[model samples]
Target: MDFDKIALEPIRLDEAFFHKLPKVDLHVHLDGSLRLETILDLAIKDKIPLGIETIDDLKAILKPGYRHKSLDDYLKGFDITLKVMQTDEALYRTAYELAQDAAMENIEYMEVRYSPILHTRKKLSLAAILESVLAGLRDANKDFGIESGVIVSGIRNISPAISMRLAELSVAFKNRGVVGFDLAGSEYNFPAKDHLKAFNLILSNNVNVTIHAGEAYGPESIHQALHYCGAHRVGHGTRLREDGDLLNYVNDHRIPLEICLSSNVQTGAVADLEEHPFRFYHDLGLRVTLNTDNRTITDTTMTREYLLAYENFDLLPLDILDLVMGGVKSAFIPYEFKRDSIRRTKDKVKKMLVEEAVKQGVTP
Candidate 1:
């Protein structure tokens, strides 16, 4: 049972193997994951200006890879997607499709996040936008048997007053479908401390809060998210590796880091996959989980992300299983629900591993 040796050995598991593994995605954005065809249809139907007619052209604009110049450049594609997402029907369809896509890859649990205020350009109430997304997810759950919830995000570049409003919106829908509150968007000049009011409001309401920090900025950003804002989890704390004391504090406190590999690289958070801190964080026993921050925008999926980890990081089957379980553990759900979900998913993962071991002529 030399796990390190096994991890170092070349493994031959294919896409099918990863597809069957039960997974959880704690930090996926809804507005950034619209399918290309769906985007085209929506743009045409709503007369949204995409500046691109064909799918190939749209892909070029939206599917920028990991070599992006900076976080700001990487976010340019959202302008097109968000434009078409201002309607109730568009919101429902996008949310429904995101769930269906996650279920197709055996992502049993997920928290899809978006800023409700961003969708209100069409005069739609924040409540209406939230309900539409919830209705779509609820329908997807009934149809596909995938458990899902919503995390309302407040933008960092936006006004703090608006972030406070979004926090209240999240608290208002606490049990209905909203599970957490998050602060997303750009990370450079826009500090998380600026939105302390929103995070405090979310905390006061007994709601879970995760803030985007250390992606574009330094560990001080993450420190503010934890010390000032009281974040329960951290999104893309990639730069935490730069600060030894703070990194140790995060490990000691067992705060989970939502590590979206491809998205991080695409946003210039890391030099490349080889330089990523995922292995560093995991080896240090930090509660780290892999995610596809923007599935469509990054042109990735949960399965693809797992496969990339396997190929790049040389993670063994057990390591991959642990990562999947970490995501479930880091989810913003009730303790009972988290325990039950992990129990069931672990059983399934064990069974899958046994089957794979047998197929590979290895002892289970």
Candidate 2:
């Protein structure tokens, strides 16, 4: 079992920075991040025999060793979560609670992804699943004031026809809440090029598209994601750092990489935090955004990710602030909205830093 915890030291910082900082999460999987207590409660209510008697048992199932050996192994965790998310009640609850968790973390905006097909086993139609997720988001919004949207994903290993249907569904619901279409799943055997028709359909319909690329494979996966699949953003594009040309191209285009540091480490996307390509990409001025791919599976949160990155990378407050701004800039929103949001966040972060520096009697 290669379940080594990534070594990390606590980052000593001012309290104000954590509280006042506004952030955005561009990539997160809804079902993959459920609270363990919620999962257990739901399992009991639904009479789903989870075999595990305690939270520790559940944690072991989600640990890296139990996680997929390849891209396939990583995605297998979603199956267990998705099984518990079949009913409209469960789906809505998970989506709403995910939003609540994001709000608690002070995430101002976030986009959640899931494969609608995976949640339809109980004869719940695709529209029904989507509607349930939207209902949860709306419910959470009324309570927490967090902005959220959905990105419907097509399982990459599935038939191309099914992929196209998913893309069409994403297009149909774009105005409703579906902000984009994504190709997710195993990356080695199932390349981005395998779903070109689906991505093309998405593009033709003017639906935003992103692809899970460069996580389990190499730079060619990223190339196909951008060039062949027409992906506007790359998910877990850790392998892009291996190629200087690809890195330059990504920076030149300002394409955002949705980085999941802990998830990457746990899933064997990289050897460890020190080996994480996020530092390389950030140093090269790539549009990089930090995220919790699956909070429970990775046993992490956005705040924890920031703290670890800060300590491991020796990142300054301004750099952390810049990363927040980077997430806003990379959001799959309309141009005007993205521009205005980034500008406002940048100004707010600057003011916050200045206030902190004043309190500490140091120039920041």
Candidate 3:
């Protein structure tokens, strides 16, 4: 139990070790995280025109893990997935499958986010869209033992009035299944302040707020998200380090940044892993948590994200413990829930590391 005295350090750990550790995914997208084969299956079931029948052909077109020229370019992959998600069955199946996949990798908790308006093309009511996905998550919780919640998103590129509508949905489902409200979409020209009405409504209802900022834009976007929109957490804050003053404010406030490594690289948020600010932010004592922003689209998993940190950053067992604990703290759950998770995750990781050290013939 005396972790400080133990020399349990592994900079480059086996991927299987990462898979064995209990994990939390706080920022995965439901629409973009679909399995390619599921997309093809749903497309065939719904008679949607994907022009491809095979998974390999679909992968060649969707181009999972493809490095793109810009954030918008990286997002174009959603156009294909959205085609088959108009029905309740598609939404339910995708949500269940995503949770099942996350559970298989030992993810104990997950929060999936998406815009209901995007799935309304087939005359589905907003409430119905939300319920279908919630049902899938509920079933997955029963079958796979993975707890999950939904974060209804208001698209930044869309109108503020629409964002307000989504905010209302978040409030209506506050204790039912929805945990938080988010502003996600093209953040280039669409500033977070433009969605102030939505955030205002969300805050008035005491709903949690997390906005996508400083990824496709600069630190100024992050500033707007915090100052104007009143975001509790930031998504893909890769550019927050560009402004030292803002970075210090975030650090002092202990605002968690949901950093998605592979997605950041594919979206051109950072040039590459060497250019990523994850190591910089962590070294400065900021609350940074790793996530797979889009699992299938970015071809990443919770296990892969942790491995990226292990290989790219010089992190010790305690540092990895800190990162894992950071995720529990950033979750939108109640404080009492987070306290339990933080304690349990710390104990589990420490015990696992001790065993790993023993396996390597190190003194316990």
- The best candidate by TM-score is 3
Error of 2 at 186 (Å): 0.8
Model 2 over residues 1-364: C-alpha lDDT tens digits?
Answer: 0101111212245434564578888889987889888887888899887787677887777562343456567777776787789999999999999999999878999999999888877899988999999999999999999998899989878888889878878988988999998988877788778778888888998988888889999999999989997888999998997889888998999998999888887778887788998877888888889898887777777887777777788886557776898888878788878888877888777666555555555531
Selected candidate, larger TM-score, 2 vs 3? 3
Q: State the lDDT of candidate 3 residue by residue for 139-180, as single tens digits.
A: 999999999889999999999999989999999999999999
C-alpha lDDT of candidate 3 relative to the true structure: 0.92
TM-score of each: 0.96, 0.92, 0.98
Which ranges of candidate 1 are over 4 A from the true structure? 1-11, 64-66
Clash-forming residue pairs, model 3: none
- Every candidate's lDDT: 0.89, 0.82, 0.92
Candidate 3 TM-score, C-alpha based: 0.98
